[model samples]
Target: MKEKNQWSSKFGFIMASAGAAVGLGAIWKFPYITGMSGGGAFFILFIIFTLLIGLPLLISEYIIGRGAGAEAISAYKKLAPKTLWVWIGRFGVLGCFLLLSFYSVVGGWVVIYTGLSVSGNLLHASADYADIFDKVTGSAGITILGLLLFSLINVIVIALGVRNGIEKANKYMMPLLFLFFIILVIRSVTLSGAMEGLKFFLAPDFSKITRESLLYALGQSFFALAVGFSCLVTYSSYLKKDVSLPFSAGWVVSMNIFVSLLSGLAIFPVVFAYGYQPTEGPGLLFMVLPAAFSQIPLGGVFLSLFLLLFLFATLTSSFSLYEIIVAAFTANRFRSRKIVAWITGLIVFAAAIPAALSSSLLRDFKIFRKSVFDATDYLVSNLMLPIGCLLIAVFIIHKMDKALVREEFFLGGTAKASLFSLWRFLMTWIVPLTIVIVFLSMLGILK
Candidate 1:
């Protein structure tokens, strides 16, 4: 039998896992969604959900992967053999495939924008940034090329294997992402009328909290953490046994939330400073941000850096998505990781073309009253993730041996026995019930 790959260090594992968790959802979607959902109130609810639900589920995946010490599909099989429980892992693989299909589309946009920013194409544009955004996304050549390039980047990194590729890249990218955000925030908050944006983002308005927004917050928490998709399972499978699961989970969650808050701080202040409405939908980051950056001294330089940071975040997440599929197919020795990564990257790129063209050639394409891109996003975010999370909670609580779970939790002998019971109760009860309610509510069945 071939030896399994493991993380070289606990820090490497945390960085790689945190890289998976902190993606476009945190840096791009979170700010705009917060702006639209009434800022501080939605932000507060998102944090609450992260703590009460997302954190436990995160630790759940860690336990599942590290305990089983296998790929996502094999992990479940190892834990509960000769049963349908492995389908949870299969569901995760499918979910991740569908996820990256659209996710890469946005990632491609970031790649294209990064290029445009570097070449001064986006500088001092007097026209509406919305128009510029449309032109870029509407071009099939640009979009497809960008998607291919972005996918290629993912393939190259993952092909190097986990420790040297994923871990090393994350160690640098995560800190760079933070440093860039700090610079943007400093520049943004000093602008005239910036305090209003700060107020909007930090001051909770309870009236903004509605059923839909609450549901949105719940979903966003899950999305932001990259839970329910078994990406974490694959990453954690590479972890060493000496690593504390709870401590690792705490770092990922805290870093994710901090980056989210930083994103809001960096974006909203600039949006208000430029007198643009915060609720500009999906194009807020690509469109409104360039316009805001155009107003500052040496804005072009900062804009380029920001786009690079954005692309870094997207690529890190894409690495995890591709890693899950590649790891499963490779199965440690079936095919080389490089060969599998190339094949998988090609498939994902080809699959994502429709989504990439959704703004142009496939503009008229519709499924279930949504465009191809929107439909895929909805299916993954609204349906697949919640169901996957629910099943994982059930399996961990009911299928696994209590003694094994206790051993994994208390490996370092730091956490108390009472805390293990609390975790089990949350997984068995709170996590499942919350996911089901949110899933039903999203389906309009709860009202």
Candidate 2:
């Protein structure tokens, strides 16, 4: 049998895991959703869900991965041998495959936009920002090229193996991500009229909470943490036994939430300062951010930096998505990691092409009134993720041996017995029930 690859240090694992968690969801989606869902109230709800649901499930995946000390699918097979539970990991890989297909599409957007910003194409624009965005997304060739490049990047990094490739890249990228966001926040909050946006972002309005918003907050918590789908399971499989799973999970959760807060601080203040509406949905990052940057000094420079940061976040997350698949295929043959990574990257690139062109060539392609891109995203985020979370919660609580669970929790003496009891309760009861309720609400079965 071949030896398994492990992270060189606890820090490397944490950064890589946190890199997976902190992606475009934190930088782009969280702020916009918070704005649309009533700002501080939604933010508070998201944090609650993150703590109660996201954190527990995150630790659950960690336990499964490090406990099994194998790939995502094999983790389940190892834990619940001779059962159908391995399907959970298989579904996770499938979900991740579908996820990265469209995920890379948006990652491609960041890549293309970064190039535009660097080339001065985005500067001195007299046309509407929305029009610029439309032109960019409407160009099939550019979008496809960007998607291919993004996938190639993922392939190259993942091919290098975990400690040397994924971990090394994240160590630099994650810290730089934080630094860049801090700069943007300072610039944004200092802008004239920025206070209104900050107020709108930080002030809670409980009356604005709706069933739909509640569901969104739940989904966003899962999305933001990169929980569910066993992606974390793959990442954690590389962890050393001496490392504390609970501590690692806590940091990943904290870093993700902090980045989300930083993203809101960086974006909303600038949005208000620039007099743009905050409810611009997904376009807030692509459309509104460029316009806001245009008004600031060294706007082009800052825009380029922001795009680079965005690209890093996207690539880091893409690495995990691709890693999950690659890890599965290369489990028994470690030397084949490079070949598997290339093959996986090519497949994901091919799969994502339609989504890349969904705004143009595939514009009319619709499933339930959503374009191919939107439908793919909807299926993954709304349906697949919640279901994955539910299954993981149930499996961890019901299938795993109680002694094993206690051993995992008490391994490093980090978590107390009472805390383990609370975590188990949440995993067994609160987490599964909340996910089911959110899923049913998404299907309109409740209302």
Q: What is the TM-score of candidate 1?
A: 0.95
TM-score, predicted candidate 2 vs. hidden true structure = 0.94
Alpha-carbon error at 396 in model 1, in Å?
0.6
How does each model score on lDDT? Answer: 0.85, 0.85
For each candidate, what TM-score against the reference?
0.95, 0.94
The segments of candidate 2 whose C-alpha lies over 4 angstroms from its true place after superposition are 1-5, 125-127
RMSD of 1: 1.9
lDDT value for model 2 = 0.85
Question: How do the residues 122-237 of candidate 2 rate in per-residue lDDT, one tens digit apiece?
Answer: 86646477778888889999899889889888899888765777678788878988987887788788889999989988998899998778888988999999988999898877
**What does candidate 1's lDDT look like per residue over 125-148, in tens digits?**
585787888998899999999999
Error of 1 at 353 (Å): 1.1
Q: List the residue pairs that clash in candidate 2.
A: none
